[model samples]
Target: MAVYVGMLRLGRLCAASRGVLGARAALFRTWQEAKLQSVRPLSSREADRTSPLPIGGLSYIQGCTRIRLVSKTVGQCLDATAQRVPDREALVVLHENMRLTFAQLKEEVDKAASGLLSIGLCKGDRLGMWGPNSYAWVLMQLATAQAMELEYVLKKVGCKALVFPKQFKTQQYYDILKQICPELENAQPGALKSQRLPDLTTVISVDAPLPGTLLLDEVVAAGSTQQHLDRLRYTQQFLSCHDPINILFTSGTTGSPKGATLSHYNIVNNSNMIGERLRLHLKTAEELRVILPSPLYHCLGSVGGTMTCILHGATLILSSPIFNGKKALEAISRERGSMLYGTPTMYVDILNQPDFSSYDISSMCGGVIAGSPAPPELIRAIINKMNMKELVVAYGTTENSPVTFMNFPDDTVEQKSESVGRILPHTEAQILNMEAGTLVALNTPGELCIRGYCVMLGYWGEPQKTKEVVGQEKWYRTGDIAMMDEQGFCKIVGRFKDMIIRGGENIYPAELEDFFHTHPQVQEVQVVGVKDSRMGEEICACIRLKNGEKTTAEEIKAFCKGKIAHFKIPRYIVFVTDYPLTISGKVQKFKLREQMEQHLNL
Candidate 1:
C-alpha cells in the first residue's frame, strides 16, 4: 500500500487450523443466541424494511435504525474493547513477524501516547505520522493524530510533532526533514526551534535514534514513570467524542488537496456500523481475521480496517509494509484470514499474479472493494475466483469518514455488482438536480448529497471551501452524479465535473467505462472528455488490455457500436498500460484528460 518493493519473512502464528473452522461453524449459533438474548429487532423505520418510493418520486431516503450510536472517543472505544477481549489477538504484522493481543496493543498505544505527552504533544496538538504500515504505524494511528503530504499538511494544521521511520525504501525521512527544516540538524531533542516549520518542536524516529531526534524506544521508556502515567490519566479525562482525531487530505485532482477533518464520534460510529453490516460483530477473534493490504494512512485502513476490527474484537493482519499481491495471498493462506480489504486495482493485481491459483485463499469470505468504481466484471471475478462470496462494494469520500453505503451479506450478486448498496444507518441521502436545485426523481441521475453523523466537521482552516460543498442544512454535496433506484440502491454514474456535454447532449464517462469493461480484451478503462472545436467536447477512451492481449482503436470502437447510443461511443480510443492514480488508488481522471489533450493537440 505504501509502494515499497521488498519481501518480508512470513509469520506462522495463526497458520494452523487453530479451530477456526469449528469457531466459524459456531458463529451462526452464537449470533442467534446473542440476538435472542441481547440484540433488538429491526425497527419498522429502518431503511431496509421500508417500502420503495414511486417511480417518479423524489430520490430521498433516511436510514432510521434502532442501533444506537457509540458515545465514546476513539481512545475510549479501544480501551473498552481491550478490557472485554484482553487476550484476543488484536494486530499481526506478518511481514515484520509482530503480533500483539488486545491488552498488549492498548499498552503499546498508551505508552506511545504518554511518550508523545512527554515530548510536549498535548491532546489537541497535531502530530503527523509518516511511514508505511507496521507495528509502529498502528501505535501512532491510535495514540495520536495523523497527517500526510509532508510540508503542506504540516504547515496547514500546524503540526507540533512528527513520528516517522528512519528510512522507508529509498526515502530517508531524516534527510527530508533536514531539507525542510534546516534548523533540525542543530536543534536539541524535544526542543526544536525552526523558521520553516515553527510549530514543530519534536521529532521521534521509529527505527533508531538520529541526531537531534529522540528514539522511539527512549520516548517509550521515558513514559513508564509514575509521573507520566498520572499525567496520561489526567489528560484522558478531557478527551471528547466530538474532538477531531484525523485530518485526511483530499486527492486534489481538481485543486490543491484540502484536509478533511474527522471527529472521534464520526469515525467511531461509522466503523461500528461498517463492522455490523459486515457481520464481524458476530464472530470471535479466532473466527475472524482481516488481512489489510491497503495503507494504514488511508481511511480504508484506519477507519474501515483498524477501527472496525477493534470494535468487533477481530484480528487485524498486515501482509506487508507495502502492497505485494503474492505476499497478500500468502498471508491469507498462512493466517487463514477471513476478510481482505483492497481497491479494485489491488484486487486486479492480486488476481493477475502468475501463481495466483497456487494460493489457498478459500479462507476469505468477505471484505470491501472500494476507493474507486469497480466494474461488474471484476466483482463477478472476485466472487468466483477469490471465494469472497460476501464481498461488498463500499462508496464514500474521506470527508464522510469514508463509508456511507455498503452491500449487505444477503444482497444479490446484481445488487453488489451494480449498486453501491443501501445508505448506512443514521445517514440521510438525496439526489438533487444540479440545474434545478431540487430533489430528483427516483432512478434519475443527479448530484448525490448526504447528511449524517458521519459527515466531517469541516475542512481544516478552510471555512469558505467547506461552505461551498456543505450547506447550512448540513447536507454535504458529494459532487458525484448518482441515481437512487426504487429499492433505495444508489449507483454512482460519474463525477459532475467529468460529465461531458457534447452539442447539449450529456454523456457520463462512467457508463462508457463500465461498458468497455465488458470487452474481452480490456482489463481496465478510463473514459474522459476531450476538448473539441465543433461540439465543445468529444469522448476519449483510454484502455489497458489484459495480459497477452492486443487490440486497436477501431476494434474497441467496433465493440461499442450498436451496443450503446451513438453519441455515447468514444470518438478517440488509445491503449494505455495504466492510468494516473492517487496514492489511495483512485484514478486521476483530470490527469488522464490532460495527457490525452496534449497527445491529440486539442
Candidate 2:
C-alpha cells in the first residue's frame, strides 16, 4: 500500500485555501509494526524466558502483562472520558474562578478545534501552544492534539501557527514575536511573513487582542458554523496513534534542547498507566481533584498531571500561573483537592511557609513528588505535615512521555524514599554495564535504558543525533546510572558522565550529595568533579548551610572522615547560599563545575 503524506502547510490552512493545495501525507517508516510482525515464534522451552533478547547477569524487567493498552488518539481519549461523565467536574482554575464540567470542556475543545480548522489548521499540522497552566491552555492542547519553541524550536519543527498569551505576567510574548517577525506588525492574522520563521503563518493571542494578531475568542467564534464543526470532526477521525501529537523540548543543560516528538500512542498509554499506579481509577465514579503547580510546558504538568486527570475523569486545578506555595495550599484547602503534583523544591517551599500550619491540607490523600530527587526528609515532611498518607515518587525523562516508573500508593515510606518504583505497564527497563556492553546483575549499578511505546519518534530533524542514544532495538539509553532490585524497584545512582574517576576509583556524586544532606548544618549540597592533573578529577562539594549556621571546609571533611570512604569524601568544600538553577529548577552542575574550575584554576 502506498503511504499518504498530508500537505505540510495546512497544519493551519485558511478555509479559502483548503482545496487550492492538494492533499498530502508523508511516508512513515512503519518500522514499529514491521518489528512486531517480524518477531519469530519461540519454541516451548524458549518461551519461559519471556523476552526475545538473551541476557547475562543483568537486571531487566517488564511491566505486568495483564493490563492492555488503550488505543486512541489524545483527542479521542478525552472524548471517551467526556462521553462517560459529561456532567462530571473536569477543570477548576482556582485563581481564575473558572470551572468546567466534562461536557462543557469537550464543547469548548470541539469549538476550539473547529476554530483551528476554520483558520486553516488541519490534521498533522504543527501548532505551538505556549502559556501557563489554564483552562484555555488545556483546551488548546487537546484541540490541536499536538503542541513550543522560543524561536529555534518553532522553526526547527516547522510550526505553522502559534497560540500563546499576549503577556505572561511580565514576559512580553507579543514583543518577542514582533522581534522575530518584524512584518507581523502590518501583516494580516493568517498571512504572517518572517525571514526568521518562514513556516509561521498565523498568530493567535489569548486573553486580549494584539496588533496584527487574531483574538482567541474570534477564532473560536469563526468555527461556530456547522461546516467548520464537521471539519473538526473530520480532522479527529483521521488521526492515527503513531502520528506525532506533541513536541516537548528537553532541558538544555548540556547543550541546545532536542525536540522530542511524541505521538498519541506515546503519551496516552503512559498517562493511563500512571493514573493506574496512583490508584486514580475512580471506580466509585467520584471526582478526584489534582492541584498542579508545575508549568504546562513541562511533561510532569501536561502529561502526568493534566492528561492523567482527563483519562480518569478527574478535576485538574491550576493553582497559579507559576508555582506559588501559598496559593497551592489555599487551593488544596478551599477546593478540597485530593491530589497534588510538584517538584521536591516546590514541596519544600510549601512546607517552609510560615503560616503553612494555618491551611487545612487534611483533604489531600495522595500526591506525586517528581522533577527532582525526592529527599527522604522532604518526602516525610509532605507525608506528615501535608497529611498526604499516600504520596508516591516517580522517575522518567521528557523523552519517555515523562513517566515510566511510579510508586504504588501502598508502597512503604522506606520503599518510596529508596527507589523510583517499578516499571509502568507495557514498559521495559534494563541496566546495561557501561564498559562491557551487556546488562548487569540485580542491584549492580549501570546505565538505565527504556524501551516501549513511550520512546519518542526521535529528535525532530536530527536523526543522527537521535541514533546516538536510541538504538536499533528501540532502547533509549538514559544517561542516568541506576540499579534495579530483585523486586523491580529502581534506584537512580548518578549520571554516567557525572561520575568522578579519582586515581582509577569511580565515585558517584549523588551518593556523596545524599550523604552530605544528612549533615545537620548542610541544607543543600551538590558534589561535582573538578579536573585535576594529579588524580584526573578531584571531588568538590558545594553546600548551602542552614540559616544562621556557619561551617568550615575542614569541619565538613572531618564529618565525612569516618563515615564514608576517604576517596569517596569530597576533597574540597565550598559554602554558598544557593546553586545556579535552570528555568525548570534543575541544578546547572556544569556551571557549578566551571565556576569551581575557574576559582581553583583547575
Best by lDDT: 1
The list of candidate 1 runs beyond 4 A from truth reads: 1-56, 142-148
Write down the worst ten-residue block by lDDT for model 2: 23-32
Q: Give residue 527's error in model 1 in angstroms.
A: 0.8
lDDT (10s digit) by residue, model 1, range 434-527: 9998999888999999999999888878999999999999999999999998888999998999999988999998898889989988888999
Model 2 regions more than 4 Å off: 1-57, 142-149, 282-287
TM-score of 1: 0.91
Q: Largest TM-score belongs to which candidate?
A: 1
Residue pairs with clashing backbones, model 1 = 1-322, 1-323
